[model samples]
Target chain A: MKPLTTEEIRAVIAAGKLRDNLFKATGVFCLALALIVIVALVADMVIKGSDRFTLDFFLNFASRRATQAGILSAWVGSLLVMLVTAMAAVPLGVAAGLYLEEYAKRNWLTNLIEINITNLAAVPSIVYGLLALGIFVYQFGLGQSILSAGLTLALLILPIIIVATREAIRAIPAMIREGSMAVGATRWQTCRYHIVPYAMPGILTGVIIGLARAIGETAPIITIGALTFIAFLPPAPLSTLGDGSTAGLFDWVMAPFTVMPIQIFNWTSRPDPAFEVNAAAAGFVLMAMVLSMNAVAIFLRYKMRKNIKW
Target chain B: MQIHDNPTLKAEARNLNFFYGEAKALKNINMPIYDKKVTALIGPSGCGKSTYLRSFNRMHDLYPGNRYEGEIRFFPDNTNLLAAEVDPIEVRMRIGMVFQKPNPFPKSIFENVAYGLRVRGENNKRVLDDKVEHALKGAAIWDEVKDRLADLASNLSGGQQQRLCIARALATDPELLLFDEPTSALDPIATGAIEELIHELKKRVTILIVTHNMQQAARVSDYTAYMFLGEMVEFGKTDEIFIKPKDKRTEDYITGRMG
Candidate 1:
């Protein structure tokens, strides 16, 4: 059939090879582009912020006296708020996740709930800020306190935790359930003893990732009316956000609190040259916290994959 | 011609009918699983042989839209399997099973066998160590994998994995071992090894195996039950079932005259 000219055959082969080549190259190109973008972003964040990384930046709270100020209060505030959020949100989110993925009956209500959760996950952090402002501050009388802000952040990130938990649960094979049942294990035992242990790493990874997102958030805490300029190192303890006064519940409701995002926002906007360096250093510290959480997540993921059996 | 009752005819089914929604899967299954004797169920694919076997422990209970309209009873000394108060979990503990695929829990080899012992609440390390070794030896895989006890079971070969599953089931020290096409997923060499193990196993425990391999049914089982279209067509001594089956259908199946 190819008794024709060599050049023509060569041309035809080249065209076919090029088409096949392009088909395979498309996926590779997409992957390469993704890697390049990630590298570029990390490089940019590091260059812009890391040079100014300092200990004093983490020790002293923001001061009106620009040249001497650091992100101490904001750092402490962010850590406190996130810890509280993690404490409040993780258990509830994971429990809800377990119920939905493992125990929920396949009914209309569950379907509705699942759909709403997905939509909630898509809701902008800005909307959560508005939610914090209206219900938490005004209606519930929580005001702009760290407690109110933490509740807002918890609500914002709970959907992510649930979704991640569900995925982790789903990754467990049906055979494990069957095998457990066949060996006289109760349904609860199958879940609690066999299933949950297997799903732990994935769920942990999800929580760490969700926390990273929560810590990096700015707009929602802003809407909660977190103060940008709080000279005090949180009043309650190593972790209190505002004045730490739940004053008679109602008076307590009408108090002001500040968080890391507000401090970052406040620092980033100041009209001073030295304050900008503190902002970058604070940014660096913020990046470290998020990256460390991510590292824990990555380690958990590796352990999970290594330990997972067929 | 003779169906002798060994004292352990502890588990018995009388006119049991299993239906999957609208489709009848097991029709009037009247079988007696004798104590301490291997009774193998052999049939072609889709013959409801596994269905009859699964009915013994009600393994299909978890599946939706499947119903049984007849009785499966256990002995008084053994407790009634069909009793309303009877827990399927307890029944499962009594009648442990191994599947066609080698399903090792994503655990260490030692942990896999020890899983049943642990579930049964035998936590003593010495006891676990002994039981693990005993069960492994019983399945004829102990010598091969005895050293790699702490390694992941997924690292084992197909045959070794299947043997490990058998060892795991055996660790519970169940009265009956239900093997659902156990060797179907194995190579010829592995299949032979498992068959030899089964021959050795029937000496102590009741082994009920389901297989499409007619030769295997003839080779391993002391008593063989032939099934087709959800019905137990004929059952007798393995030699008689293969050589001189009373029913024309059984003879047809054995002689390759029919499926």
Candidate 2:
């Protein structure tokens, strides 16, 4: 390298330093802008609904009036629907993932199956609703029920669950499996005893993320035509099929029922100005519910992480 | 001449060939792993020693598209180890393997040792505790881990972890044990401890060890097999191979030739 005079050195250093600083400043500005947007959005949501968030907002049921209305039914309905979705989806989705990751051959057939699953994940929520109506409701005579709606949403989110589960399963090293098998454990036993336990945290995180998407979904459940008004607790001793089109006490899972988002949508659509506040309050409820669910998920993840030996 | 004989063979590899796709990693490996002896597969790096050790227990099949051909039998029945109907899982239980690095599961030290037993469906706590103690003692780490059994296995030092792996493998009561560069990831002290343990273990379980450390092979092994580029170069008693190897290549390898 040629030795440079002081001025030449200063000029060269100045050019490189300025270029580096300019890029650094741009990165800082981008980060600041993103933070500002997040804070502003959260501030707005809190300001609008903070006044209405009384204990009753979480405690009581929905009303047609703005001032007196609470989101109890919607909250309860959402819980029932979410629990139903979790009940239906988690095992099936995880099983599909296990099969794809551990058992599925790396042939064109498996590739095609994987491709189709990816496509299914991308399909619009409303399209799932339509499919649910035609196939689950009219075609299969499952009817417009909470169970049917939960199943519909489950199917909609299954692709994501499977993909995430596969990712979790894939994260475990081949060494762990071999180590287990080296001790003479069968393949299924190895997975059940070793791989699944190790992969559980990621699987739970993925399931929670998928469930979050399902919770926020409105179009499909609406398309499944879950009822907007029901003045009773969901069936406690639940049945599996047929309670939507024609009402019967025994038919629990297949019966049509409303969820929080659907109820919120119904309230928000009303011409009455009072229902508007209720909808906003319902938004708060929904957000709080999602936040708590997320908190639980985060807690589990932390525990899983803390508990892992490696 | 029949160089090694056993009342009951711990393992036998007959014309064993291993391929990672088309590249042969081990070729025509005909050897007897005698019962209750430390049989070290020693050679220079990339000399198919580890490959041969892994092939004995079918650890070679873990990766997709990797293939193994020819027969590997286990004693005393000389079971057809290569038969398609033979479950590799069972073979693994009978012929446990330890990797180059100590790999304990992300679990309590007690649980790590108990993993093999758990897979065999042992659920009684007292039995598990007894077996864990037995294994830990067998691997020469019972005093170190007998108290803190609930602690994570990663908390153990390098040599301890390797011993824990041995204990875990031992918990399965394997007929033969394979060590694939077991001390390669360990320090000199840890390596010495492991080498000493391996020497003692030969009284009970047959051991097939792969080692790059020439001194380690010479110190610990009863019989030695030399391999080069996936082919067996020499097979003889440990002293004969190290002190006066018949093949020039084996002598060169023992004396650091083209390796």
Candidate 3:
């Protein structure tokens, strides 16, 4: 084989540049297309729903008349469901991730668990709803309550949080672990002092993003039979204390719940065009909440990476 | 100091054999570490000097599937360190290690130095502050880092980080210290500084070091052990090992005739 001449080399370099530029342009174009669609949708929602985007809209309950409908119950329900999901998922997922990464030996059983967890992440969200319906709603006899809905969503996002936690834990270099171990720290102590703190930002980011996804999830909660219409707020944990009600803090967990997405779904399904506007407003609110959560996670990750050096 | 006919042994390895799954990483080995003295293990790469150093504290326990066949006995108690009943964590507390790379935790300098004490549940601020300062001074880094104790350890220079790790290890008041090519990642000046620190540290703690640099082994060690192919070929006074080695392999290695 002969080596390339200067002209041939130049031609090859030019061709490489051309191919690189073509790929870059193609990627940019696809990204721009997606961005355009998202902008168009958000803009349409804003224009259509701007009239209803008011303090009153947030304060009013669902009404028979679309013009008077508000998302007070839906937003509150969304907040409650997310609270349950975060509380249930974060610790459970992190513990499972820690066990898998730090303690579990490389064996058939661990490998099997790892594979199934990854597979579970890809299973459709609605399937989780069915599982929750079967277990929490029927077998456990918890019925279609906030507890059932929260548990179902927790299951839905469990795989995501676990995967993220593992990734975050894995990002820490082995040298840190060795450093801690060399100093005579026990396994649990090393994990608590060195590994977990170093990986906290990553873990929190994962949990927040998981929570964001859970906030927007409608199918699974709907499948678990979350009500689309609930005029009265789910009794707050302390709401009954000073309100002369018989309900206790424990009642809220088993009480019926309605989330924002379900409320949006219900409004959009109505025949009235005004109800469509209401749906758009509610959808905008949900989008804002999810995007803000993701933004906060991104900001935290940036700060953590900036402050921490290996 | 008056010399005794028999030196007090800090730790002793008896016919030690180590295996990494099916492949043997070390053969039968016997060596004694003297109290308050420095022993340097010298050999080329893959000669198992680092492996032998780690065996003393069982650093290899962090990984699975690695096995040890013989005992390394701790003095005073005569505990077989290689035995399953012996806890590696406890062994490590008394025998601290400085790795080839300066791996200070990503934390404040004070926190890094106090980590050992903190692990043992010493939460009193007064105790931690006093001990942390003492350790930093012991490692000869207090003069440089005294004012910046709250700064991130990672912000320090390579030599400073290594010294901070030394301080962290020393804060526990260990009986022995292991240096596995502790200066390999540093510049010549930093290496010289670490060598000086090692020389001073032997006054209070037993020291064992492994180094590929023959000059470094000769310069800093009181006794030298020459290893080749996972076996110790010669062990004697540093002067004798470097100048008058009896074994042909040791002679060849010291003379740069073979690696």
- DockQ, every prediction: 0.62, 0.70, 0.81
For residues B1-259, write the lDDT of model 2, one tens digit per residue.
2335444566778888888888988888888777888888887788888877877777766667878888888777879787778877777878888888888888899998999899888999999999999999999999998889999998999899999999999998888889999999999999999999998898788888998888999999989998889998888789889888899999888887667
1 or 3, greater by DockQ: 3
Task: Give lDDT tens digits, candidate 3, residues A148-222.
Answer: 888888888889889988998999999899999988899899889977788888898888878888888999899
Task: Write the residue-wise lDDT of candidate 2 on A43-141 in tens digits.
Answer: 665776666678877666666556666666677777777887898889999889888888776889999999999999999999999998999889888
Off by over 4 Å in 1: A1-13, A23-51, A130-147, A235-257, B1-8, B76-80, B257-259
- Candidate 2 backbone collisions, by pair: A60-A72, A61-A72, A66-A274, A145-A255, A145-A256, A243-A255
Instruction: Evaluate residue A303 in candidate 3 and report its C-alpha lDDT on the 0 to 100 scale.
Output: 84
Evaluated against the true chain A, what TM-score does chain A of model 2 have?
A: 0.87
Candidate 1 vs candidate 2, lDDT winner = 2
TM-score of each: 0.86, 0.92, 0.96
Error of 3 at B241 (Å): 1.1
**Candidate 2: regions farther than 4 A off:** A3-21, A59-61, A238-255, B1-9
lDDT ranking, best first: 3, 2, 1
Candidate 1 local lDDT, A89-120, one digit each (tens): 89888889988877777778999999999999
Pairwise DockQ winner, candidates 2 and 3? 3
Better of 1 and 2 by DockQ: 2
Model 2: lDDT to the true structure: 0.83
